[model samples]
Target: MTSGAITFGVKLPNLSPLASRDSILTTGTVAERLGFTAVWASDHVVFTPTTEHDHPDRRFPVGFDTPAVDPLVALAAVAGATERVELGTSVLVLANRNPVVVAKAWASLDLLAPGRVLAGIGTGWQENEFHALGAGDRFRRRGSATVEFIDILRTCWSDPSDGFTGEFCSFGPIHFAPRPAAGIPILLAGRSDRGLRRVASHGDGFHGTNLNPAAAGEAIARIEKYAAACGRATASRRYTTLCELDLRDRPVGPDEDHGGIHLVGTPEQVAERIRAFDAAGISHLALRVRALSGSTRKEISNRLSVRAGVEQLERFEAEVTPLIA
Candidate 1:
């Protein structure tokens, strides 16, 4: 961990064709070598025509038409390729799969990476995805299902027998083995009220997106308030977030506000935003950088080639890492 700066991770283009074996291996190795604390793989099971998130920021994973790779499988390959960088799913939508099975997959990922897996998860927004996965019925109740889902994961990794009896799933006795030597950490992502409460109730951490210092602090306060109300211990809870990184040679004037969706500008300017996020209580910061700058907005792009994405990340390592470290 570098002092004076938050732990940093690069978001891999894992959801696209760029997640080819060669690309994953290269990206993971390069990020680890560049001193990144982790390399994250974003998840999606199937992309329908309705899959364009079209977030106002136009972030990566903008279109579902792109070739998609399974996040856990990609990261497992990355685990064999890199020695240290943490492998994360920058959220697997819990309602899209059976928790018992996905829990095993994540545990197996840990066997490969040891304590290096951050099982970043969330109750997904795309209700259609649940239908595609044949779990459509779980989407509406995904919130409560996810709470039980986390319970299932904990039992899978730490307990020998299954004894849960949730509305979505029920099991009496089963043998699950070769549990992870280091228990996997579940970091829940959400911005809604139910989402925040879910994190405070069951998550080892909170995973936020597109937030600035004030916004981050405000959310953390909410998580704390929720945790206190539930009598959940807050000391071990971690806070991490993903923000867009747009670095160009031109300087962003001091007056520009990116609305917290982006950390855009020259390396120096972006570094300042990074520092602010660090001060705002982000222990780990995941930057989703792209090869090109924007599909629609002045910033944000999902059209990333392996070569260009790697180059952009290398540039951040050379230019931004020093400013913060």
Candidate 2:
């Protein structure tokens, strides 16, 4: 729980259909070599064609056609190739899968990686996907279900004799073995009131997305206030956010603005933005390297090969990490 210099991580190249397993593996190894503290993967079981709700960011389409690898499995692959970087799930949808199953999967992963797992979890936004996963009944009560999931995970990890009987998830006394070397840190994602409350009440940290420095500061203040109300200590909890980085060398656009959601422009400008977030109490930053301009997602993915990704990582390490570190 001790604070130190800010740490950085990057998302694995598993978001597009063109991203091969080899590229994903290479991305993790390169990130470790470049002195990244962690390498993160995202989750998506299925994408429905239509949704009543819009995407939280409204920048991307809400189609499940994109080829996103399973976060835990992808992280397991990364763990095998890298020795130092932490394996993280940027935001895994918890309510879609059974809590017991998730606990076992993550516990096994922790055993394989041995103290290099960060579970960034969320209730998820796609209700249609929940229905497809046969957890539609639990969708309406996702917040409660997520709380129960955390309880179940902790119980399963804490001791063999422990069990949980929650309103949504209940299990008899069971012996779960190969416990994690240390308890896996759970970071809650999303910016809703319920999300922040869950972070304060049950999570060890917060994993935010699309939030600027000012907004992130406000969110941290609110999280602290909620934590204090819940009698939970907040001084040691981690605050991490995800940002898209435009590493292509180019002049700043007069009209192009990211609304502070991304680290765009020159490396120096991106470094300055990182400093601002660090000053706002953010402890970790997970960056997604932008793909080159292309006609389609597949084309863009093709352009962002492992070689390109490694080059970008090298540049960031040389130009930005030194400035921030």
Candidate 3:
């Protein structure tokens, strides 16, 4: 397929209940049924405190508050829920996970799903979550850790004569069985120089998340620069951007602020906007079904729930999917 013709995926942040896995299971099944190309989850070990005084965009509604299930465990469940959709992470925080164990977990999932694993990774943002895992200072070195981690994962999975040693990881001369039936695509998340450079140098793909269409050019440009610097071309390197949708096209009230950057119009407009990203060099657009920011109270009860989110998904499936497909 042409880069623009490549299928789209979806990212789910905090979709599962901390107490149970059923919510996420249901969501993944629904997304697959809707014909989403892939399903991804976030990696977070703890929740930062949310208070009324904090910005509304920073806070998730109260009932939605819960610890995340380990992504590998969640993906394993998703593997069984759907046959065609790919399974992935929006960005797994490698700093918080043990590399050896993570390699095994992901490899196992790939075996279950075969050629359907997309490995999205990041350095992560929350400091408290690292502390909870006793990986605080080490988390600060996540960029380097991720490079080493991926190298180790590939190393352990292949038939190797010896192990590896690095400041962040080490393993030796042993057989790691059942490598992914097909190679997993490693999509790195971040937009800065170091991040883009790392993606170019090592990653198989790039995850451009929460970027406005206007700002997307700069990120894509950055990727092109780094990829060229590494003697690769943008066309050869895989890339995806995540776009959030709000159903309104223009301001209807005080709550309508900043929804313009979102895919907020009819299905055609959203499709055109997504096509723009593809034209700009994004091979996939990982979308989420939700509105952008507004009043905290309104956001908490009115818009941010699984029920509303699914309705939005149905709307996009009906409208945007056909246009894009």
Candidate 4:
């Protein structure tokens, strides 16, 4: 366990009641004001029955009826609404789309936010959803497709004169312009050995989802091992993870480790979990809180208790942040 300062970011409320234009912008505005390092948005083009079955209840439990905004568009809106805070996609399914178009879209967003873009990308798992997208043929080899897609993005961003010709996409000498001054930081998200190898080979950092301290440490070890084998330095490679922080008192005996990676239980327990994560080498963490979640059918369907959410974030900063090692 290494003692290091862990930067905190908040996942923007971009689904259901929190997904409204106002709520999304409000959450970004508040997170920026609270001194959070970044604001992240999750991606999902179209939800299907497969989505519900694949994801755990805590993720897509609201079913297909839940409103989820497109990740890039949501970040663009947040881009115009706030400054200083980095804009990120927790794990955009890059392999499901044409790389040229996606690259252009990301470049446009980077122009708006300048250097504050963290591209957290992954090969999507929903096979049916992959079929829904036009790139169904490439689903089987999405790992390689994703790798080539990053190549395309970097190629176009750096120099588009030659363009790219990869297994999944072939483009002419496209005139791509308005590049991000700071360049997009590519963070790879995966839980497999192949994923860890990609982290060592391609990613500027690892985007860990639902990873606890022990698991996070093991993953980092694998990544370092791979990096050493390839003569790559892992020093600049950041360790970041996303998890839910159910920072409320309850009778459930602290289901912190039961669900994915979560910071549950009292404020003290939450603080301890964060310290453990920090000790495990997580340098940054983006969290989702329950206080800011959706209301029941009796209340407004398209609204979030933003005030409660803000209070919860404030409480974390005041109470938990100070307690971490």
| lDDT accuracy of residue 230 in candidate 2 | 94
The digit string of per-residue lDDT tens for model 3 on 231-323 reads 877446677776666554433443442433446567777777777776676667766555311122334333455666667777777766678
**Number of clashes recorded per candidate:** 0, 1, 2, 0
TM-score of candidate 1 on Cα atoms, chains taken together = 0.92
Please give the lDDT score at residue 254 for candidate 1. Answer: 52
Q: Model 4 over residues 42-117: C-alpha lDDT tens digits?
A: 8778767766566544334144666879889989999998879999998899999888788888999989988989
> CA shift at 128, candidate 1, in angstroms?
1.4
Decide which is better by TM-score, 1 or 3: 1
Candidate 1 C-alpha lDDT tens digits along 91-164: 88876788889888998888888899999998887777789899898888889888888898899888847477
Model 3 / residue 201 / CA error / Å: 0.5
What is the C-alpha local distance difference test score of each model? Answer: 0.79, 0.79, 0.70, 0.79
Clashing pairs in 4: none
Q: Provide TM-scores for the models.
A: 0.92, 0.91, 0.84, 0.90
Error of 3 at 114 (Å): 0.1
How well does model 1 score by local distance difference test?
A: 0.79
Off by over 4 Å in 2: 1-4, 51-57, 61-63, 160-162, 292-303
